[model samples]
Target: MMKILVVDDDPNILELVNIHLSQAGYTVMKALNGFEALKLVEEDFPDLAVVDVMMPGMDGFTLTKKLRTEADIPVLLLTAKGELEDKEKGFLAGSDDYVVKPFEPKELLFRIHAILRRYDKAVDLFIQAGPMNINRQSYEVSVGKKVLLLPLKEFELLSVLASKPNYVFTREILIERVWGYDYEGDEQTLNVHIKRLRDKLEKLTAEVIISTVRGVGYKLEVSSS
Candidate 1:
């Protein structure tokens, strides 16, 4: 069974979430604070984490930031603060999704399942194209002799394209697959991410690998050289 860690200081909230998650057939781990959450992460990494933004010590933002540094575990931030800035902060802290307080249990379950599904689909079995090598298990991508450290989204995007080299994928399709249906962001977000990926890949080879199809989408160039 997939394991999920839920971090919240509210006893009632913890118990309620635990019951719902259990019903959904997940192994749930509970932590009342960030310290405990960190410990739980160190001991055993969960498939995903549900974190409350407001806590006594070490708020959700800090914990999420710390977690992102070590693992790419999907994080869903549950918070009473519904301000736009608060949501932005959660995203900046590496949360994969955010949910406000007083949310329905059914909605929460759906979000959890969706995030897991998206994460699972983001990576392929493996990708070997040209001089590049990708290991889905370790989430590593290398170019020729050099190992490149790519951000999670960038790596996933490349993996998707490289999985089927030369296949053109529309920007909308790429955004939906990479960012999830629940993603509430502008299309410019995808553009920026693609640019970042291009910058990183350019360091490895002078020739560009990702090609824009102009008003259609993008595809990995099948090098003739």
Candidate 2:
């Protein structure tokens, strides 16, 4: 059974999530705060985590940062504040997805399943774009004969875009495809990842392989080089 760790200060929220997740056939674990969440993570690694943004002693943002350094476990942030900046903060902190408060239990379950699907698909061994090669199994990328180490998200984002060259994918599409439909990060997250990808590719060729369409989205150019 897939294990999910849910961290929230509110008892009602935790119980509600536990009930839904349990019914969906997931083994649910609960933590009332970030400290307890961290302890739980150390004692027993979970397949995913759902964390509330506001908590006593170490907020969700800090917890996410700490978790990212040690593991690639998919994290979904829950926040009462539905501001764009809050979402951006969660993304920057290394959350894989987010959900605002006042959300339905069914919606949360769907988001959890979506995130798991994305994570599973991301494990596919390899993807190639022109001379560039990405080995998902090893989490390594190379161009021609040169090896390039990329951050986790950068690799996933590039792989998703390159997997379908010449297709323009909007920010929302990329987020859903690469980060999962539960992802609530701002479009700026995509821009940051794109910039990183471009910088890495610059080492291989002067020609830009990924092109951005104004008011549309981004696409990978079918390169003849």
Candidate 3:
């Protein structure tokens, strides 16, 4: 069972999250403040943390930075302040995702599952092709001096192809892996994303190319030069 630490100043919020998470088959731990949460982590680290952004002493931003820098734990910031600045601050503080306080239970659960899925996908969690490095955890691709941040879907698509260089992935398999089984989009969607990726790669380096396999699908090829 995966352990999740939920930190919130309000007992009501803590209880609410605990109940929902527990019901979802996760071993849930609760803390009232950031200090307490950090202390708990010292004893037992969890797979992920759902943290509130408006605590008394250590605010959610500070707590998030601590959790990310010290424990390297993935965090989902839960708070009522649904402002653009707050969201930007959350991301800048190294939060993996953010959720407003009035968020749906199902949506919260889905986001938690998604974060855990990304966390569990790879051990190394990055692919290095020549000067380009595709980091799945950070969702950023760096080529030499330039770091490119692609959209989530584009990043996932690139990661999947780069995971196995020169190995052909058909459109069906790529769509299923990147967009999930229930992706209800036309085939043109994949083509658009692939074209975008190729355009970005062209700007980065000539050593790496996303090759088309004639009528099949796409493959990422890194030149040995």
| TM-score of each candidate structure, all chains considered together | 0.54, 0.54, 0.55
RMSD, candidate 2, Å: 13.2
lDDT, model 1, position 115:
90
Which digits, one per residue and each the tens of the lDDT, describe model 3 over residues 1-225? 478999999999899989777654467989999999999999998999999999999999999999999989999999798899999999999999999988877678778878988888322377887678988778789976799999988988888777667777778768866776668999899999999999999998898899999887888898976
Candidate ordering by lDDT (highest first)? 3, 1, 2
Q: What TM-score does model 2 achieve against the real structure?
A: 0.54
Question: Quick one: best lDDT, which candidate?
Answer: 3
**Candidate structures ordered by TM-score, highest first:** 3, 1, 2
* lDDT by residue (tens digit), candidate 1, 117-188: 888832346778887888977887787678887888888788767766776777865765677656788889
Q: Predict model 3's lDDT versus the native.
A: 0.86
Better of 1 and 3 by TM-score: 3
Worst-scoring 10-residue span by lDDT in model 2? 121-130
| lDDT tens readout by residue for model 2, 116-159 | 87888323467776777778778878776788888888887877
- Residue 217 displacement (Å), model 1: 46
In model 3, how large is the Cα lDDT of residue 207? 89
CA lDDT of 64 in candidate 2? 84
Clashing pairs in 3: none
Superposed by TM-score, candidate 1 places the C-alpha of residue 181 at a distance from the truth, in angstroms, of 15
Residue 7's C-alpha lDDT in candidate 2?
92
Worst 10 residues of 3 by lDDT: 121-130
